[model samples]
Target: MVNELSSTLSFPILIGDIGGTNARFALLTDAFAERREFPVVQTADFPSIDAAIQETVLDKTSVQPRTAILAIAGPIQGDEIPLTNAGWVIRPKTLIGDLGFESVLVINDFEAQALAVASLSAEDREQIGPGAIRPAASRVVLGPGTGLGVAGLLHAQHTWFPVPGEGGHVDMGPRTERDYQIWPYIERLDGRVSGEQLLCGRGIMHIYNAVCAADRKEATLETPADVTSAALAGKDPQAVETVSLFATYLGRLAGDMALLFMARGGVFLAGGISVKILPALKRPEFRIAFEDKAPHSALLATIPTFVVTHPMAALAGLAAFARAPQHFGVATEGRFWRS
Candidate 1:
């Protein structure tokens, strides 16, 4: 796949950022040109990847792109790409031929996000902690969206490398006594506690339910938006508490990912949930939880964290790769693509 796709670097390549709920597509026509305007299409509205592309992209673009790269919300596994949260699976065997593209490169969404970090400016993100990104240093990107996505980026010899993994599924524990009390209830649902169990959008509902259960209260929230709305309005104390715990748990996982990747370049947070719950994340509790790792407490404090606000970050990253494949250390070797 590397040899096949790597040799096709050209102008006007199709670049897409796909997730469980939304799909965004753009055309990168030049090395430094701004990402071409694109639209956000609902994932549920389209039955398959090719259908989504044909309706939202192919019919709209006049460039007639022959090559493409897509950043997906799931693992880019062999033959088939399985989305962890949505009911979509990308089968490369019949996909490219159907799309009428010469070849296509598929990658993890967070990996594309990690690639976008290379070109991010101050205005592109909001800082949550107190450290700066070191030039050419290793950085990590993670987000709580339809599910939690994690990846690391490193630079060596002018090439940005993306290390993708299912880090969100790792077993996690609580820090506070309140957390201890509520975790038992959450544990009953999943049998095991992973970061995604209580950090993503549905995770917010889980935390809200657990908090309500521990307080012997009823759950009024049915979705993540409801939790955020009720909490921000101060209409529901349980929702407020749930968002607080959500930040702490997210901070914990973000800090852990930073440590695992030695993300001295900084940690970039993405996802729909993170953006919607910005107020809770800005509180001191989030920072405290992030820097709470003892012994390395001071070390974690030195790593900066930010919330990605750019809607097209993953697309931008994929654009960078489509512009110059040699500029990234992306895991594409031995990867397969059908045409």
Candidate 2:
């Protein structure tokens, strides 16, 4: 039975999944079983998350959500969160004080995503490795998009521990002569090579340029969408090679993360680019590169790999965050709900 508070507070919850490119807001109608419930409003149409929330609440429904949780693509410390990729800086206290939300929670975008992973279903997950999840093991989550986001989930004391890391900035490895050749190309731009340099949308373009440069072909770097479309249409050889290499690098990174986190639960590939390259990622070369780790190749192969197909994974995560006991339990002090 739903508690009186849970039932009484059920107008809806305002939740946000803010990233560098967009800020997605949603109304979580059902607090329980959030894995399959909620409706999201596209953030691109709105200037800011606050505006989106206002418009959504005003235009969509009259029910006022007492709680708000914002998962941002930047660090959340104290009252200020300036977006890493956008021009918005938010203060949670201001939202609670001005917006009149009963409570507001702000966390790292990947951290919110990690929380949602615990509630993800088999149908929601697209496996990357061959190993069956051990039912009760740690899982790591990573996505390649505007930038790379990394986090891990460890089951502890009946709740999932969200351990966020700046793993995307970690230096990547070069397994092939071609990879070694391209490494320097990226190094020329950034003093050091990070995984984000070679695995995101612009990363795909970078890879294409390096490949064309290596082949001594004059190349024009195109936008990610153009390149992906060309590769999908089989009209551009350089685009094809660039996309393939991007997939390979992603696999290698996933493999390394699986080993580091002992992610026996699975390796989830979530992001705009992964969804765009789903057809190519299903190819043998991508799978081969993911399992190419020597000595521990078998181990890498055993970890299940998946592409997150849900467009609302982050929104679902926000709903989950609102209900998680560790987050909302024992609200006290000047916390919005308590007021």
Candidate 3:
């Protein structure tokens, strides 16, 4: 299925990485040219995506794009696509008519993240543990931000296929005695605690509050930043424990993905939180937890992990696809729309 949809798209392609909180855009003029990036805009600042594009992209640049390749922070289901954590419901047909584009391709945001994993250079990511990447092996990319996003990249027949899914919502349970204590205080969505419940931006606060509750102490940190700041500063015990436990849980999940995909190429951590918590992730706790799976612990120890350091990794991924769709096996049967 590699390059199945390559012929359907044309340049100059407008690529966007639409997340819950921010929307970033860039224009790809041709296959070999660099992308022309626009200023980042808050998703809430505009009433709709069309308006944001008009004000922030089209109006400012002279280059007119014939197609749009968007990676959104939600599933692409139908004509009306709602962002998972924002108020924007993207109507692709509406965009085609309004913006005079010939095609609009929408995909899950983490698919773009996975694409980034396939395309990023050595300097774009920082190694987290002691494992060498096995060439042409499948890989996993997950990020903890407004929410936890997860995806896998499979390499077959010299093509990279990005597998996008709700891996972040996978079932997460307590293992250690410390986890059992804090698990009770962790927020539950629906009735059970998922990986997202304890691995997102708010998840940091959840861990902090859980730590405070487990110790029968008052929770002082209100936001995820406050907790991370205090933890990084080493001034607050609860905050420090919260970050440590956060790293542990993140490692556990990353390891789970590595095993699930047999991601010998590597497992990448993207999103703002991963970059911010680099120091903590570099510590022994994260790697120890990652390699803790008893039966397959040795296997996990051989799989590398990294933190994606590029600021606009999603955009870079989209640009890579826009530049040469033939290199990626992106399934666009239902996701692709044309005027």
Candidate 4:
């Protein structure tokens, strides 16, 4: 009877999608077709991911999962990775031993997010411009939010594989006289400027300052939300120019990414800013800059672009990762993998 009851009780697994500021939790209840099911809890309510899982499982029901998967913000190299913006240092083996789980998988947050793009259906995506999608070609996923995130995916043997990278740290170059002027202006504040410098939330303010400096106006540092508010109200010229320049740079970077990967499958723009400033992205200058890649401009025009509307798409990728056996290849003694 005990064996039958154990078989009947599904693997109430634990899954999480963590970022700089928050860690989201979900419960995968069933063993069969479990990834399709959605069970989530906000990270703000709990102090840590482990605490969140423990409290959630206890409050919901008595189901102990033998396996857990957590996707966190940072590169996965060795056993420990300090979260980009948080103080916690995640050690895979330590957590696994502490939790008494048979298996625990940790992956790059952006890689986990990339895994979901191909898995997402038509309903989850929205068109940003006119371009064709070549499903067999390489696809690029770049987002500007808490930080600039980049990842690439290749489709092979009817399966999608994610390639994690630190493309955000790539140097930012100027393509025009205006961009040239802005580039040097930003250089004054930063000795070595990366795309993340002007592509993230703080990046909006940097662009705004650059525009202000170019116009020989006094610059005032402000938060991303404040600048967006002022721009939406049409009350601040600096904020207005900031958004315009930001969109243009976004287009340029997207084009560059497309060129780098020959991303014929598609180029997706994600992050909190894209969704918040959807109206601004519709401007002519934005699309024009996106397609203005000099000789390769023609190729850029043919590549499809989009903004993922679903807030929980990354979590969906976490679910997909949990379902894929290849994601967790060989188990090791300490924490690192050999294959």
* Predicted model with the maximum lDDT: 3
Q: Residues 213-293, candidate 1: write the lDDT tens digits.
A: 999998877988998999988899999998888888888888888889888899888877788888889998788988888
* Candidate No. with top TM-score: 3
RMSD of 2: 4.0
**What's model 1's overall lDDT?**
0.81
Per-residue alpha-carbon lDDT of candidate 3 for residues 1-339, written as tens digits (9 for 90 to 100): 334457767889999999999999999888899899999999999999999999999999888899999999998898999999999999999999998999999999999999999999999999987999887999999999999999999999999999999999999999999999988889999999999999999899889999999999999778999999899999899999999999999999999999999999999999999999999999999999999988999999999999999999999999998878899989887788899
> TM-scores, in order shown?
0.94, 0.86, 0.98, 0.85
Return the clash pairs for model 4, or none: none
Evaluate all candidate structures by whole-model CA lDDT and list the values in order.
Answer: 0.81, 0.72, 0.93, 0.72
RMSD in Å for all candidates? 1.9, 4.0, 1.1, 5.3
TM-score (C-alpha, index-matched) for candidate 1: 0.94
RMSD of 4: 5.3
lDDT, candidate 3, at 61: 88
Please provide, for model 2 over 272-330, each residue's C-alpha lDDT reduced to its tens digit, 9 standing for 90 to 100.
Answer: 88888888888877778878889889887788888887777877665765665454222
The per-prediction tally of clashing pairs is 2, 11, 0, 0
**Regions of model 2 farther than 4 Å from truth:** 1-11, 29-47, 187-190, 324-339
Worst 10 residues of 3 by lDDT: 1-10
